[model samples]
Target chain A: MAKQQVISPLPGTFYRKSAPDQPSYKEEGDQVAVGETIGLVEVMKSFHEIKSDFAGTVTKFLIDNEDAVMAGQALVEIDG
Target chain B: MAINVISPGLATSVQDLGRPGYYHLGIPISGGMDRYALRAANMLAGNDEAAAVLEAVFMGPELAFTQDATVAVTGADLPPKLDGEARESWTSFAVKAGQVLSFDYLKGGARAYIAVSGGIDVPLALGSRSTYTLGALGGLDGRNLLAGDVLPLGAGTAAAEGRSVPAKLRRLPGAQAELRAMPGLYWHRITEASGRRFFEDTWKVALEADRIGYRFRDGRPLEFVERTPPFGAGSDPSNIVDSCYPYGSIQVPGGTEPIVLHRDAVSGGGYFMVGTVISADMDFIGQLQPHTPTKFVSVDMAAALAARHDRQAMLNEIRAMLA
Candidate 1:
């Protein structure tokens, strides 16, 4: 099995979708590539785009939208 | 190789370069407090500068290496030893398998960095391996090192050769390290006397200091200009607008004392940020022990840039020498 790499660039609440009512950018088993925008992290009223650093399939979403996360918390896992 | 911990010293945790770009989401950059020393140790071990390292505070753990490994210790000198013999710092050395490493009480400074060849093998979380203890994230199970923990080393097995300890570690000059003042959102709201005292006086680190924040013992109480209604739901007049705050911001609340936030500080805060310690001087701040007298010096934007450039040049020179 290939190693799955998880990347989270910022410290904030991980939001899976653009808005509360929308679906997530990815689901389990979704194919994702490096530099692909995976989700948004909202910090202090500013929204930042979290991008995938590895080309792989999304194996898991470790955090739910609106969940508070510290710096370096894994938000998603990518099977590289 | 593996290292077993006998006594997990005070507040020991795994750290790297820290997590950035998440302030807007209310996550502060949590990483090694003394970043320069950490980087130097990593470089000595021929590891990536951001590789995971053990951050030991005050006292350190008694570690037993399971295999031969190259290691470097940096930052605060806690009287570390290998197999009961004194160990040198800021230079890499070979540790025989099964040799015991331990640290005594800190004589100077607050924390130390232990970097193994390659790096510590903690799974990278949020692009870093630093532990944010308050949030319960990163490091080994998102907490301080405990007894019986075994940390794995990274894949590389290259041993360090010709260890050379420098006579003195470079530091930011105290005269040039007056804290810098940017006009924060609520900077103008304080009284003129309070503002003057903020620049003129030296503060003492209170016993309440920790990774979360360093509270200072200022002489006089700080009074707000006026109390206004809550800005938003759950917002109070004491709260300032949430914005990006760099490391070393000295935030003053309703109390007289100021709190100097460190690596594990929260992303955004509501208190008044009176001044920010320049990045060049931050490492020095990390070396401060409890009750240490800290004088906040003011640095203008131009001076801050010059200091940064000067430090970068020093780093480049060190790299060149190593090459």
Candidate 2:
């Protein structure tokens, strides 16, 4: 099995859930499916979904919730 | 015919060139932040240069077409998609009724313009369809687009598809940018060194930057010449007896951060305006992203007017090419 990391497509603030009160979209060791949004990256006050392109078990997130991130920064890891 | 809003991306609103004549009446000429890109998208969609279009900030709205129409996406590259399939930007594409148009993450630039063949059929306010969100005037009910809002479309012809702008001609937004400005007005009120340093320092775009004004991160505090406060002027050296603020006016309050008033800025203020961003460079200012390192370059009036002429010529060239 190969491990892949989901990377931020743009630079902005990263949030694990859709809203502050919302639970995490996916948890560690959870089975993730393709096209599933695991988090959101906000830029210019606009929220953009960070979708998982690979289906796998969630290993862990590389960044914390609400952290400022850069483009190409690894956001989450997955074991496929 | 109309387009149904599925999800209104952060602050999606209808905007055209703007309302200019009513500024003295306390109205801001709120319009497309990046007029060049707005016109580009409009021309590609075969609409008039000043046709109302959706100004989508970094993110774009998910719109469902109720009728077949042609559209062009310009300005910030939100990575537009039609029916989940990637569509080319800075160009026109026809979408059939029921096809959903959305966007991927922003690749570059700060805003995106979506111009449909027939413009958004909002009634004009003061001769322009531009939205002034501060006053809640114009656009669709004078505010940002909301989910479920059905926008009526005007009747117009569309150009052929695949009308792509040359990459060189497109905007290049980056972590660093330089904008040209013409100094004067209340500039002499500032210490000579501070005025010189203003142009030399690289200021970061503050997070609060918006259509009304862009406040840059203060790298060095500016110093103003001491003078007796005029009758209505506040005690601060930066305060002037209230005066009219020109578009792109750069004013400083508290002698620190410089705020460059933009297209939607208020008509007048009590602050000392040190310089004005050249008309041609205003579009570049609109494309600046937050935290970007920005610089101000001082230019003479001759150069400023020359740049304006060059921009006008470029618009003409674009119109002829698109035709």
Candidate 3:
């Protein structure tokens, strides 16, 4: 399997889950399909979902939760 | 001549140049924060200069056109994408029915404008279509566009689409701005030291900055000239007799954070207005983002008028190019 990266579409703080105390959108070894939401990028208090483009199994997140990210920044790695 | 709201991005609202004559009735001139970009987008979309456009703040919406139409995305580098393909800003493009337009993150500036070939056809209240959400006065039921709200469209003017504003004529905000302000009104109430400090200090925009007002954090509390409270005025040190606040007026509440009132701010208030940002600089100020450093430069009325004239001339040039 080839490892592909899922990138954030916006510059903001990346969150693994919708909010704290909630289950994460995706976890390592979890399966995801194209257009499946993996996380969220929050900018200026607005939260936008981060979706995966490749159908694959989640490998690992490149950045940690609550980290400030730039546009097109790598968020997670998916094993396609 | 219709659009389906797929994902109404943050606070997407219908706005135009706004109704200006109703301020005395406590109605604010609620319009696009970045009017310069709105006008340019209208020109590109072949609409009238003051035609209604979608004003997206902090983020952009995902809109699906119901019919083939021309559209322009302008202001803030939200980096719009059509059907998942990246599109250009400050330029018009054609949208086929069922195609979707979305945006990437904001790269520069604050607000992003989306102008359709035919303007957003919401019913106008008080002679304008601008949304005053506070009053629920105008626009699509006088509120922000929500998902599933299908907006009607009007016939556009004959302005050619695909025309672009020159790179030089485009107004984008920088990390910091030196906004021109006219100091006076209740500026007398401000202590001389604090008054001087305001011009010298570079203040950062607070997180609460929005269409209503932009509050700045200068780290220094402003001191006002000591005086007894006037009738109807609260007992705050920055208190004043309630008066009409012109758009872009800077009011310091609690003598701490200074807030520059924007399009959707209250019509009048009892707070002291230390300065009024000039009309030309409003375009610049409107593009300021949170955390952007800003300085206020005081200017005379003549200079203010001259700036306004220059801005009008530049708009005319863009119109001439589009025409």
Query: Interface RMSD for each candidate model?
Result: 13.3, 3.6, 3.6
Best by TM-score: 2
* Distance from true location, Cα of B8 in model 1, Å: 0.8
- Candidate 3: pairs in clash: none
Kindly list the per-residue Cα lDDT of model 1 for residues B66-173, writing each as its tens digit.
988888888876666888888777767788898998875565566789988878888877788889887888888888889999887887664465454464444422
- Using DockQ, give the best candidate's number: 3
Cα distance off (Å), candidate 2, residue B31: 1.1
Candidate 2 docks with a DockQ of: 0.22
The TM-score that candidate 3 achieves is: 0.85
TM-score of model 1 relative to the true fold? Answer: 0.74
DockQ of 3: 0.23
lDDT of 1: 0.73
TM per model?
A: 0.74, 0.87, 0.85
Cα lDDT of model 1 by residue, A3-36, tens digit:
5656553344678898878888889899999888
lDDT of 3 by residue, B1-323 (tens): 68999998778999999988888888888889889899999989988889999998767999998788888988788888999999889988888899999998778877889999889988888988999988998999988999999999997653444678889898887767888999988999988998998888888776577788888886478878888888888788888888888888999988888888989888887888888989998877667766677888889999999999999998889989886
- The DockQ values of the predictions, listed in order, are 0.01, 0.22, 0.23
TM-score of chain A of each: 0.88, 0.97, 0.94
Stretches of candidate 2 above 4 Å error? A1-80
- Span of 10 residues, lowest total lDDT, candidate 3 chain B: B155-164
